[model samples]
Target: MARPDIVELPLAGAFHYRPHPHHDHRGSFSRLTCDETLRDAGMNTTWVQTNLSRTKARGTVRGMHYQKPPFDEIKLLTCLSGCVYDVLVDLRPDSPTFGQWTGIELDGAAADTLYIPSGLAHGFQTLSDDVTLHYSHSAAFSPDHQAGLSYRDPQVAIRWPLPITALSDRDAELPNLKILEEAL
Candidate 1:
């Protein structure tokens, strides 16, 4: 087994887990997550669900999404195949970096994961075809709690690497940062 080198991101509670793969005659292996490791790093450890996401085309954008109130969750997100430019915004009202955003390029070959704390909006732009992602969440999905800001929200102003090729109607209709704050 391998332990990931947990590097905290710019945002409070965000982290980048850089795993070192151990090589052998067969292949290489690494550990993605561990309770002891997470606990040592002061991260939430009670993951209740795991999910797999597959994106078939490059230049597709998904989210700027988060849950609200009692349903807010901590997420462990990893790129498993292909590449993506992952982005997130600090939506926590009292945080010093409130409304600020940050991004990182995640490569499947690196076998790394990003830690997203509660109250941050998370999204990604596929940088290669056939991208696969793994997600571990601390809470169950709740339609009523689901909310998002527009990917094109000028306030956040995310600089996606490629020209976007696809966006779902739901995402296209998400509200702006101002609306999110007012509604809260």
Candidate 2:
């Protein structure tokens, strides 16, 4: 096993992966996100909501989504059921990671979690038949404040695990990364 490496990236969030202590075939245990843990990593947002999504197939892509403006939220995400190749793009103009992207492979067997700041775009593609994603948000959901970026945007250059096979009509129409930045 590899030692847990703390990754400090160019953004307004902090993240660290703690190895899960497995005792038997039953499973392992670890906290995905804790107030004190986040605080120590430079994230001070008090999670106000917990959301989960269950995807049925490898190609089930469901994001590049975020809340705009006053409803924008910081998110802490983890994969709890299967595995996924998660991607995040910095959309905050003032951020050092602006226009940059980072990707990680998250799975139930690992104690990996992703911390995404309020102004980044997030999405993932499942690597298994069933994927359950858990997330903590710093704000409430508001349909009117919802926004998204094109998962296929060439500028962002995210390498998805599979060709996008399923997406909502709304998600399909989101502007490309470049256009979204211009519109913002």
Candidate 3:
């Protein structure tokens, strides 16, 4: 596999990596994650869980979710099919970029991955039908530790590239940013 190109995003502890895929007559091969590359960037995470989500409709939104302390998680996200406008919001009160957000278009053709550190909220909107997202997490699932901020919270005010078409009942019920702030 060729060396992965890692770029730090504006938010501290957040990174974007593009793995070099080797093309052949049949197809191509690429290493999705490299410990050496992560080590060089000061990130050393042991992924314990992997998840796959398929969004069937364009404009489908999912997220603004995170795990609380003791179960906080670092997530490595990649789009396996179609495309999405991935979004992340810094939730660490002490962080210089707290409350700030960043969005990127992840295309299956590019095979780019986004590494989201703990203490951040994550979500995405599908730009095309049948989008698939793959995620690797440093921590296992714990429903009791899960929390979220409303994706449409005025305080976060994310400008989704497409009009939202669908949302899970749970995501639709998430507390607003003001409520999250009070709890924080």
Output the lDDT of residue 153, model 2.
85
Comparing 1 and 2 on lDDT, the stronger one:
1
Instruction: Please write out the lDDT profile of model 2 over residues 1-184, one tens digit for every residue.
Output: 3234457655557453554554568855564555565666677558888988899988878778888989999888877789888878888888777877777788777757777778888888888878888888889899999999988888887788687778878878888877787777
Question: Among these predicted structures, which one has the highest lDDT?
Answer: 1
State the lDDT of candidate 3 residue by residue for 66-92, as single tens digits.
Answer: 999899999999888899998899899
lDDT of 2 at 76: 80
**Clashes, model 1:** 0
Model 2 lDDT-worst window of ten: 1-10
| Candidate 1 lDDT, 73-116, residue by residue in tens | 99999899999999999999899998899999999998879999
Candidate 1, which segments miss by more than 4 Å at Cα? none
- Candidate 1, clashing residue pairs? none
**After aligning candidate 1 to the native by TM-score, how far in Å is the CA of 181 from where it should be?**
0.9
Which of the predicted structures, 2 or 3, would earn the higher lDDT when compared with the native? Answer: 3
Candidate 3 error regions (>4 Å): none
